[model samples]
Target: MNRRTDETRPARSKGREEALDHFVATVAKIDEVLGAIKAANDEHYGTHPDEVHWGHAGDAGRVLAGLKEVLDIIEGE
Candidate 1:
């Protein structure tokens, strides 16, 4: 009889791979959102101070927080 060791084990399950893909895609989207927020801040930094004052930065912060939550969920899995 022959037995397999840890190094000879099969790859991860399909469900796990799918979950990782979903997590990676979500992270990429979060990065895009961050880039957009940074661009908005830069574009309006001097042009419209009122835009940042009117909760644009806060909105961006909220988005970041949501992204963090999603990442945490993925990590927990």
Candidate 2:
């Protein structure tokens, strides 16, 4: 058999492919959970804090949106 060249690596194994599939599924599950959380928060609108407006929670949607974008790039979707 011919040896591998310096520029060419061996083909990926099935195990690696399976692991990648699992990773994609896991990320998707996380996205689902975040969606649920956002929905729940949207449904109730939550109680007001003492003095401050608790602006951080207001940004959850934007934060999750950024994370989804990152995951999209990671999964090449």
Candidate number achieving the greatest TM-score relative to the actual structure: 1
Note the clash tally of each candidate.
Answer: 0, 0
- Which regions of candidate 2 are displaced past 4 Å? 1-12, 45-77
Candidate 2's residue-wise lDDT over 1-77, tens digit each?
98877455434456687899999999899889889878867854454555336475657667679879988997999
Clashing pairs in 1: none
Q: Candidate 1, which segments miss by more than 4 Å at Cα?
A: 1-12, 45-77
The alpha-carbon deviation from the true structure for residue 55 of candidate 2, after best TM-score superposition, in angstroms, is 22
Q: Give me candidate 1's TM-score against the actual structure.
A: 0.46
Model 2 alpha-carbon miss at residue 16, Å = 0.9
TM-score of each: 0.46, 0.41
Tens-place lDDT per residue, model 1, 1-77, is 79767664545466688899999999899889889868866776445654456476776678679878977996994
